[model samples]
Target: MAKVHAEAQKEQILNAAARLFIEKGFGGASMQEIAEALGMTRTAVYYYFKNKDEILTALVEEVTLRARRLSSRATSEANTDPKEWLRTLVHQHTMLILSHHNEFRVVDRTEQQLPERAYRANEEAKRAVLSNFTAAIEAGVKVGVFRVVDAKVTAFTMIGMCSWPAFWYKPDGPKSAEEIADTIAELAVQSVIRPARRQLKSAGDVSEALALLREDLDHLSLMIEKQPKSG
Candidate 1:
């Protein structure tokens, strides 16, 4: 019980530090600030972490381990559909970003600030995650579900698309993280899937489609103009 409590305290400290690191860059956030945010004495904070870098290292290590585990699980499913694998990857990645927003933001923005050894370790874990995506894409291509393309490039693109939400996602926003994840997962699969050839539309049909698209664009513009801007 004591060990569990200690682990919980350490997690609390890391969460506080992650929030400060997100609000203020790594260089700008101090141990004093983290301690104050958690309502603990600086010495108490030191009990769990020797310094800011140590705290950052812990956060990175935790994220890396989790990513590796998720990647392993994603790839281990026997004969899973490639589209299902992609959906799982995107959903898990999005949920991770949403649940650990501050930690992920800190890692994304302050990666260069980590010690060289720690940075390299994190990169290895990241590569493992990327490899899982690449494997899934290649499998899809082999099964004729996806179009022929560079699997590595497509994996990177899908990762970038999924990771972008960590920067803009809000828990209280109009769309829940699950909804956003669903949309991204659909788009990611669509991006790689082989499209069925269809007969070309006549000029009149194309013109009508374009007019409908214009109306939708106009409606979207008006909606955006009505929304209040943040500072």
Candidate 2:
């Protein structure tokens, strides 16, 4: 497992660099500081990453690669149903941000400092992700599954909403990442789903009524599960 060990060590270096980049801007953080953070010599750090720029590039590449994979998986899972597709996208995106908040924050804070290659790759990945959201919203509108709204605007808003948690999510918080993801997914779906579709009492047919009731129950169950218990 030499390769596995090597990969793990590389990840350790990336993680340390991300933390330093978040605390100090990319320019402010140096290779020596990163090495010190990881209890490694400057030479050891160079073995993994040639320099601070290379480390930042690695971090950006890792984040973009994961985003691309996430979009592919979400699209494959709900190709036909725009509502399901959007929900899946939101959940996955939120989970990704929560899991890699430091990396995400560093990238955001140092956008101008990113290497040309890394910046280009990141923008491409972001455009693809946005396309997924926009296409899903448009499909939902076409099928009358969602209300009439600007798909691009909604996509941008939802994306911003999902990314906001990266600034404040806490690993030791009361809610787990999965729980927060579910909550955000539900909110995103609700925002686009037609008003009649959301209200159980207003459902026009028995099947529609049942579906709405089920969704409501699922959301209610999640809320109850998240409640703080009395001593």
- Cα lDDT of model 2 by residue, 55-151, tens digit: 8788877776688789877876776778899998999999989988898888777778888988898888889888888888998888888988999
Measured against the true structure, the TM-scores of the candidates, in listed sequence, are: 0.79, 0.83
Give the total clashing residue pairs for model 1.
Answer: 0
Evaluated at residue 203, the lDDT of candidate 2 is 34
lDDT per residue for candidate 1 within 48-106, as digits (tens), equals 99998899889987676587788779889736578788888877887777777788888
Residue clash pairs of candidate 1 = none
Which residue pairs show collisions in model 2?
Answer: none
Q: Global CA lDDT of candidate 1, please?
A: 0.84
Candidate 2 has an lDDT of: 0.86
Q: How large is the C-alpha RMSD of every model relative to the true structure?
A: 10.9, 8.3
